[model samples]
Target: MNNKPLAERIRPEKLEDVFGQEHILGRGRILNRILKSGRITNMIFYGPPGVGKTTVANIIANMTNKRFYKLNATNASVKDVKNIIDELDTLFSVDGVLLYLDEIQNFNKKQQQSLLEFIETGKITLIASTTENPYHYIYKAILSRSTIFEFKLLNKSNIIDGLKRAIKIVESELKDKNIKIDEEALEYIANVSNGDLRKALNALEIAIFSTNLDERGIIHIDLNTAYDCTQKKILNFDKFGDNYYDILSAFQKSIRGSDPDAAIHYLARLIKAGDLISICRRLLVTASEDIGLAYPNAISIVKACVDTALQVGLPEARIPLAEATLLLSTAPKSNSVIKAIDAALYDIETKDIGDIPAYLKDAHYFGASKLGRGIGYKYPHDYDNNYIKQQYLPDNIKDVKYYIPGKNKLEEKIKSYINRLKGSEL
Candidate 1:
């Protein structure tokens, strides 16, 4: 049996063999243009894991036909970087060197700074790969010297293509073993891997290796076998890192955007990361801030879901959480309540505001009536239709309107009712 992993065994050697990231690697793309020029410069590949950052870096070095040296920033010391630079200098060739650094974000300020002179002098062409936002993690000095190419997660189609290629390679190696994989099994692996081609390939390898051939001397991988092999989908979420906030942002935005599918997807990610508190808190906020008066009952539903989730944690909690996510995502969207409150608070903080009107003050307090606190206060209940228009705001801001109803059906009804009441008072 070959000890090498399937992903490593079938790693793409040429740009054409690369399955995903067509946006950058496709014909007439920026990477293609750079490769054709045969003149490489310092560049950073920024993206999620298993998205071919290291693969692309290797391809660049191979295509350029330069002296290739690789270093993992995690364990490589500043001395190691200097040693590579010194070695490249001895080559004394015009080709220059291609230094592929993996996890460049791990390099500290001192280590990163050490590479400046070498890169600046054009003696070392840096091809760095990082699973982080380079702007936030990498030093500005290094970023300024290198062009950044963002690699996005492979889409479903791209992942499926990669899985097919892996399957073919495995079958070829097995030869007379007569291994066969159902199309649905391939799709299941693709879907569960969530756009990580390396993960999909690994899952395929596991399913094929773990399953025993039937009496017919043929190994048939079915959907159930695939699910059993790749039961736990690897979630790219860090509970204490930027991904935490990123997933939360995506969840709330999906609900606000009225996309239940996206909201549930993000919710699943949070659940998989065991972040129940964030899910409940964000859902509650979305209910009030996004749904608001558009669906006054949404807050209650979300609160119930949160309470239920807190009471019964984990697997069961997912049910209520899913309910709340779907409810808030489909509910009529509105931010009128938040907008009104923010507008009122802005005026109170920035502008000189008057006190409460005398008629609206507490008349039951001692000596309050003597000070004319309750004077001229018209009781609406005593008027015709039990309605009256009285000044609620202070004398200075009586004309100000803050609580404008939203465009949803419920808010529109409230708006009509308010208009009718005001007209009757007139």
Candidate 2:
């Protein structure tokens, strides 16, 4: 009967107890600087759910020797925020105050402006957390006054570690009870959790109840038991916030893995559930990034899918998406473009390959001729345009060809064009 929501019961007390985000909180990081001094400048933590934004906020308050005034932007009135700020004003002489705003994006323009003066003047050390993107929700004026830290969803490995930690906590809590979780069950819980530790632990707790048959001190969680518990399963779109990315990732992996069936399945799910137009737009990105010159039409088809979406509207538009997914998935795969561009970019980042080749430079404008922009530019229109060899690419990549066409039947023509261009001598 002593139920305090297990996640809350085991909420970490100190920074060390927190599971991840070592990048920001670890030694010599900004957080360490803030913690050692107990002086928090205005900061906004942007990320998905259960990624330790709120927990870190609390730890900073505790570590800084500052007064903590918690406010939920969702429920807090303008007066509530003002009162919290006013209280901090009174405490200015005593000690610094950390005003922790949960779901800070819910605060409207006026509400945000009210806190701007305090934040800018260092009258208040504001630590705000938001699941929604602050760039879209938080007012620009207030956002400029604060430092933003992005939090990530717990990765699969991190989730596994967290689950192991949670299991110890769960077992310790039920010291007198006969309850247990097996590896298969843990794996199932971890996979189904989609990177939310709290959800995984809760699901594990439910699974244990549903499967009460213990065998020789080991509580086995059978697939059937898990199935029964999650029979009416639903995607945790709210908690994970991977609606578009989830579908995008699935499609990409499937296309790369060459599983048209899975690609179609995800396509179906996305079309049936959310905005097909957004899905089409992402497919266009993947078609270019992943499919590339292997199937140049992949990008065109994806664009067509988007155009189809915009023109046809939903309900009827899922057809083009399905077609696009099928085409791109079954189409020949190629990341040659990805590989080539990345290599070129790596050189750019690492090397100081000089300016544009003179012939390849612009020649049309007045100052361009004076600047030696197009000293020896080639005019393909004057030639057969077929054999005119020009230095169009960067000198570093002049000989490096990135678009190795795939063996798709239609790509045959593209391959011929590539061959002609590569071997030309105009």
Candidate 3:
């Protein structure tokens, strides 16, 4: 009401006032334990936007009774980092200075490295906030020195509670007019904001200012008004961050788990984030790793879809991507090929594999038949069904069964054929 945005005006002043991230902020949680210890360390707070990273840092600074120095890493340089350390060194206090760096991922290697000495020496307690994953964005040396706490997106109930608080603050600020919002309107805002409290509050503030007051000075907000106030919801997805990998993991797992609907949902998330290459690459991996041999042609279809997506590049790319996602999700699933290769590699690394059989050795080279290379190797093309009983593996691992076909139709056929050739059940 005093020209400050609702989000800024209602920022939580204490840990109790903060919402969500209960896994980290609830009693007996890591953060709570750290706060209760009366000593704070250099730490990184990472999460999506509008999830109280900065607010939580401020609360920690206040709760620990430390002098807080805030800097936006986007504009701050290595010199600024060094200067903050210099300034903190001069401060004579038992509670140390808390240097809260926002968008800490923007600090390149040099800038982040500049703070290591100070953090290590206890001259400054670094509280870095980033929307990106610290492990990928921050310097490993700094990561090794700091504790990392991950924040999560606020749920619908959390957003609703925050919106209700915002409404109360607005009504109190505008004492001359009564501002009223329906429950459904709040819920709509919560739903559209996609668990972002800042966006939801901003939308609520817009709705409040845009609506007309009645004769009794009551400004009523409905679902329609809320929808109009908040147009298209902006998704918070950092292509280079944890959300990107998280979505990709979920998408692949959904397809592997044979949940086309969930696969589509995660695919839509990736598409919304405008990550075409990741989608294509993940689809290819899923096709080969999750839907291998069971449907040998699935990889070709996925590859075609990927090529189409790469050529078309979004909007239309989503069509082929969707097709590929559904295809992989519905295709006969098998990890036999991947498992077979992994098992072979594991044995190669962990076991003493004997030399290749003389019959299976490379006889095409200048070695000739003098060494008996390829002497006993039978040409399967001359036999019935183009098959023959022979030891294809090394002498030590001749009986190893690495390729275990799955129970899908195609794999069942393969199992039958292999069983017939081997004259035993596979």
Quote each prediction's TM-score. Answer: 0.78, 0.64, 0.89
Residue pairs in candidate 3 whose N, alpha carbon or C atoms collide under 3 angstroms = none
Best by TM-score: 3
> All candidates' lDDT scores?
0.87, 0.72, 0.88
Give the 10-residue window scoring lowest on summed lDDT in candidate 1: 86-95
- Give the number of colliding residue pairs in candidate 3: 0
Prediction 2 TM-score vs. true? 0.64
lDDT (10s digit) by residue, model 2, range 209-307: 556555565446666665555434344343234345666678668867778899888777676566665576668877877777767777877887788
Task: Identify the superior model by TM-score, candidate 1 or candidate 2.
Answer: 1
* Best-fitting candidate, scored by lDDT: 3
Residues 1-426, candidate 3, lDDT per residue (tens digit)?
A: 489999999999978889899999999999978987878888899988898988888888887777788999999888876666666645454556789999988988888888887778787788899988788899998899889998998999999999889888888999888888988998899998988899999999999999998788899999899989997977767776677778899999999999999999999999998988888889988888998998999999989999989998878999999999999999989999899999999999999899998888778978668898988999999999898888888888889989899989999999998888879989
Clashing pairs in 1: none
Clashing pairs in 2: 38-64, 387-426, 388-426, 389-426
TM-score of 3: 0.89
